[model samples]
Target: MGMEIPDPISIESVGTWSDEVDVVVIGAGMAGVSAALEARASGASVLVLDSGGRLTCTSAMAGGHFYLGGGTEVQQATGWDDSPEAMADYLGLMSPECDPAKISAYAEDGVEHFRWLESLGFEFNRSFYPEKAVVQPGVEGLSFTGNEKCLDVAEVVKPTPRGHKVPVPGDTGGAGLVVGLALDKLDALGVEVRWETGATAMVVDGDQVVGVTWKNYDHTGAIRARSVIVAAGGFVLNRAMLEEHAPDLLAVESNGMALGNTHDDGLGIRMGQSVGGVADYLDKVFVTGPFYPPGEALRGIVVNKLGKRFVNEDSYHSRTSAFVFEQPDREGYLILDSATMVQPSYRFQPLVDGWDTIEEMEQGLGIPAGALAETMAAYDEAAARGEDPEFHKAPEYLVPLDQGPWGAYDLTPGKCFYAGFSCGGLRVTVDGQLLRADGSVVRGVYAAGACASNIAVDGKGYASGIQLGEASYFGRRAGRRATAEVAQR
Candidate 1:
């Protein structure tokens, strides 16, 4: 035997049918699959491994909205005037530490990324829905899913809709059908996809990553490959990783659940970190609040248990969700009225207690005699005057809550349906090369999607489709970069 390997790989002999391919991909989610497809198309023998025993993942569970703009075909079809400069300006405001080069690259080439996804047989509709929504409301493919148009915000970029919802409908939404189509394309391309195979550690050769040691069901062996691509997702599910790196997010009440699928346990990140890869943004988690679907909920106000308005009610869903977690006791309620139509979310069904008047509702909620009443009076007065002096809420959603039949939905951590996903992962360059603490690139290895945190790490700044868009976009870039590696070749 060459050298005694440890737990994940126990081999009696080397090269015992346990060798590998040109590109060995760990985690077969959107990023991994995208990387695999690109590598295979580049004439490299590719192998994809999944911790999940199947093709499904957190990507599959998503609404399938891919945030794309920058004069894309869909934007052209909608006759929406948008450019790369506008995209860059709008997205740069999301996070202070967001990579400047990466944002520029995304704004300039996201249209091509959208087209690449189309080449994978994924399709987006040409129509645009001119409304604010978490996902597309109608069959239209485009909508505003961020703070792009919110009032009192940075007006440097003229607003345009960017959330491109994929054409997958029914119970599963866009993820089910689009991933299925990509699977068909990968199959046609002869990409080897192995399910139930989990990479446990990196097989490093000096400063370069040679391969990885993995466990496939009962079989444990090392796959010696030319290069490795780790798209195995972030550490949201790994309690130890979260506690060690991002304790604040871990300590936050997440309604007792991590937003991602079970396989998102930081295995890929850990494997990369073992070989000098640096992880970042572990404190950033995208939290989705139970707000707006009927559009009427936008007229409502959210308050802490102390009955104080915490954020602009009209902010994007993710932004609203993050602020709710910052409230006292990590809980609150959505205060609304008869004009504010209440629509229930499939995920969040907080107790909706309706009362005849503000005073009666305050009595029912036990919000210290005059606190909630005064808050409502101020909000109603501002709405009637067609302005929100307190929170700068948009005038269109500023309809007064004066009408009786007031309602309050629980926005508590354990009670409401607040969902969060760990957005922190390995730090990478604009080209998807995993970086070290010393800013050195981990040669022969690449990472993308939630496994990397150079993009969209600001939980409060997330736009819908950003994760999916980044996965497919940078995954392909990483894939192309890996295939061009002369050492690997």
Candidate 2:
């Protein structure tokens, strides 16, 4: 089964009302914390329910890069010239189905949101790196986390540094954000936080969700509320959901690990769906990492089992990993010579199957006749001339692979070290309202973060920090909206 939704019980069956609040937030990750904080600030009584006893989920394990820009204070402080238009255009071009209004607002109001994060003591060192890597190694807080520098990516919108690397003295990125918000915002603000329990079902009054079914003390009493925010995360942790939704991930054996803890089950998404909420991109996931490094790896070549290059090897690691899964026999080889392979990226091993010549390495790897040679010959000719006519890797990385002693490293999934999480979940509008297939809203209910399917989609489209960035940002929006809706009623 994908996700089982519990049947709603009678609101009057519990004998007496255990408690009441203006808003009840499910899960205690970044999204739930943001919601509880915003709703309380809006003068509504907020109750946060967490499956885990503490605020330690996938968000706490993140690398801490929040993709924030569009003339943000850090961007301005670092002397980067960027605007909402560029950000919006880039995002719009990449995420074709994203609501235009939401995209526009996300770009336009990004700075205010950045300040909101900063106000929470989420510190960032203001410096920019124009390199091609998954996460910047040093503590410097900014980099081009997207495909902005790629030829095709550059054509849509001018590239700008947007990765907001949160500076942690010695903390993990997601943990820092979750801890700062939990301690300063949620705990200090006195939002009612309940742990070891979470919402099992939605108590509906006709069209609107009026309460949640959860254990109050020992009894499964329903907690009445004017609104509920489902931030319980994606279904990545559920093996059944993976088989039904994204079996491609499961087929890879022990290769990729899901993002969050077991509490990341899609219980919240099912709760929304039981009430007519809709979801999209359920088949999509973020397959990433084992990014071949040494920076000059871009100068080398990647060929499938057929020994032919499929994608621009210089793109993001997610993109590289994404295409590798599609190759015949699910095999690919990274051809590198002695000079280019000097500093082997410890990310993956076997050090590219060393040989004295390209042909010898090609034969040893069992590549198709003449395919690897032709591929290498073209790449060599291009690099010697300071250009890649086929893939368009930058000239700066266009060094010749002529010094002999060539080899091939396997890029097959399950064989390479990889880690990721699900990106698809319940579909929501910019305001965080869960939407039905007919475009009607699931009133008094909202979702954000990994559960919302707003920002991160496939690995190819992801920029580091986007999941955390949009989760916290939209969680605030959802909170204010849910409270304001109750006030109007």
- Which candidate number has the best TM-score? 2
Could you give me the TM-score of model 1 versus the true structure? 0.92
Error of 2 at 307 (Å): 0.9
The TM-scores, one per candidate, come to: 0.92, 0.95
- In model 1, how large is the Cα lDDT of residue 225? 76
Give per-residue CA lDDT, model 1, range 144-250, as digits (tens): 87887777563456778888888865324586566667778888888867888888777766788878877877899888777789898876777776777665456
RMSD of each: 3.6, 2.0
Question: Backbone collision count in every prediction?
Answer: 0, 3
- Name the lDDT value of residue 483 in candidate 2: 97
TM-score of 2: 0.95
Q: lDDT scores for all predictions?
A: 0.78, 0.78
